[model samples]
Target: MTTVMCMKLACMTECTRQGIACMLTRTVPYATVPSFQKQDLNRTMDLGLAEDHFSRPVGSFVASDIEQLKLAIEECKKLILELPEHSERQKDTVVKLIHLRLKLQELKDPEEDEPNLRILLEHRFSKEKSKSVKQTCDKCSTIIWGLIQTWYTCTGCYYRCHSKCMNLITKPCVRSKVSHQSEYELSICPEIGLDRQDYRCAECRTPISLRGVPSEARQCDYTGQYYCSTCHWNDTAIVPARVIHNWEFEPRKVCRSSMRYLALMLSRPVLRLKEINPLLFNFVEELVEIRKLRQDILLMKPYFITCKEAMEARLLLQLQDRQHFVENDDMYSLQDLIDISSGRLSCSLTEIHTTFAKHIKLDCERCQAKGFVCELCKEGDILFPFDSHTSVCHDCSAVFHRDCYYDNSTTCPRCARMTERKQDDISDVKEA
Candidate 1:
């Protein structure tokens, strides 16, 4: 009638009392009724495995080795049986026994086999191949995240594990591990590292321990910022393995390249880049390219003479009454270039700049009409764009800040009211 775990403990207890010649249960017995499932952190109890599948403490301490484990388990159980129900030690003893039993079973069969882990470690140590970095094994929950192959997560359930941990997994296995092509591409986001000692996980609300290492958080490169590891993993567009990948592809270059004219977009009601004037974009791109070409030419001057420059130097400088012609040419002045401007590509650099400046001024006026900037601080854009809180003077048709007018107000500064009043007084005096 004794439980199988109890019998194992009883036998170990008798080992020290060998002088008493105690007869112990020889065969490991199974219970007809199963043990109650213990609740996990996720609150789901695993009930697939049967009780007594391995030797464990029914209600005792278990240590690293079998002998010490047996002794500790037996002692705890004895105290539990003798102590009062309300004994504080009794509850702890029960919890300790549960932990030890789980540990005992764990040593018997690891979640990942030795061969798999060894190969994974070997792959990690291999040189020359570019691989995503990692430090923890979510499967074992024992190994840190480093030196593992690319993580594999269930497409259906999001159960993640080491690449080596997959073969041991059964069906539900759809396709094989994507060792090469399926490497996750990280999103355009930031991996924020924090130095603070105390903080809670933005997802779980659990306090993050900063015992030895810097705390890690994910940040959105665009709008909303900051996410804890868990929230960053599950909810964020960028995955951990992909975070490093996308950073090189986006942000530093793409933001400025593709979105170089982002400021122009603010004027549009829809706020889309596609709607921007093509002439403006083309002109900007060409200007940048031309500038780059000029720099290259300057850089190569010591090594090679460019054809256009060589022609200009040898023919034009030598022949065209050169100094006088250069002095008379108004190629440098924007207005003169615009007056003489013709074909699209034939436009002089000065003319191109003139048109670009005009476009910007129009866009600025449009933005101002949309309340993007304050008329009172019309020159604020010389520093940074300011928001509008406009107040208009009806008498003089001038606009300024609502706050400024209230702060110091009642008269329109530009109306010349006082001067007009003096003029009226002089006229009245002459009439008298």
Candidate 2:
């Protein structure tokens, strides 16, 4: 009767211990309860404890020690609850360890419905498997190294996507190629321009151009269709679109046409190359060479001769000077003469020479002044001995003493202009 009573007490103790463990699993939401339960059951089974032995009287079972078993289970619960939560890397390590422990527990039990634990184990293993897979950039197809943080996997191939490029995704096209082998070989091709094959722009049934060649192709997480970068980026609603060139062309044809047009304009028969002013001739010759090279032709296009280009071709063949007379009053300066010669200035060279001659005189009109002046002042008083009177302002003339101008305020007395007095002018004025 004592053995039966003791056995009943031990069975109650074991049940309480298992209940506490189950309660702990429920209280800690993040804890892996299913794994811990399996582990406890396996350890109990390993100790050679039968399912019925748990119900046997404590005194009857010499192998059973209830106190020791209770102590071990309490310690395990304390350790699980006190597990440290640290950095993400440390957390991952702990999770992996937990998964390994759970897997070992699963191996011991063949008939446990531990789906949650299995899922956690699978997630942990998948990360390890992905580390071995090579990843490349989707846009450039460049290989990546180290822990890939921003990569997506599609159809067993891994591709690294930039934050902006994450939106673009498409499925790869499969193609079959025949080689020397008995059967055709299957090959993978990037799916680009697939949509254009069937669908056409509503207004113009013209096929849209794709922007870039496909490097990495996968199904779009959002749209679920294969698309090239060009079509994907374009606004589909807009039809009959115009395209702009982004590339600059070398030896541009537009420039060549412009140069030819400008050359035709400046080639005039009346404007003789040899007769042109040396400076103007050099400028036109340099311009012609530049036209031959097609440099600066863009700026010269607007100034090209339109009507004169066609007329001058025939006129230039018969090289002749078209000369005309000019009235005296019609001319101005040397610049005016050149302008007239080039048909730019409306006046004649003869008019220009006549207008200039009126202002210029061969002999001195004032005092008929020539040769030496008075010896004392170093100026000539009179041109001839017969001429006794001064014909010029005496203050500035050779007849006057240099000091005389100073005595009279050092100014030309007749013209009221400032003058430098001579030494004789000072002496003569002092004597006066």
For TM-score, the strongest prediction is: 1
Number of clashing residue pairs, candidate 2: 18
Instruction: List runs of model 1 lying over 4 Å from the truth.
Output: 1-87, 110-136, 139-166, 169-432
The 0-to-1 C-alpha lDDT of every candidate, in the order given, reads 0.34, 0.29
Which runs in model 2 stand beyond 4 Å of their true positions? 1-82, 87-95, 98-131, 135-173, 176-245, 248-432
Backbone clashes, each candidate? 12, 18
1-432 per-residue lDDT for model 2 (tens digits): 234334433332333334423322322223443564445444433432212222324233232345434444444334334444342222322332222232232233223232221111111111222332254445434432212223333222222332223444332211101111112111122223446344332212334333322221222211223433322322221000010011111221111111222123222222222223334435444323322212222211222223244244432222122211111122122222233335443333234333322212122232133323433344544332112232335444433443543455544543343333455678789999
Q: Summarize candidate 1's per-residue lDDT along 118-213 as a digit string, tens digits.
A: 223212211212232333333344332222233444432234455555554432321232322222222343434433313554333434443522
Worst 10 residues of 2 by lDDT: 238-247
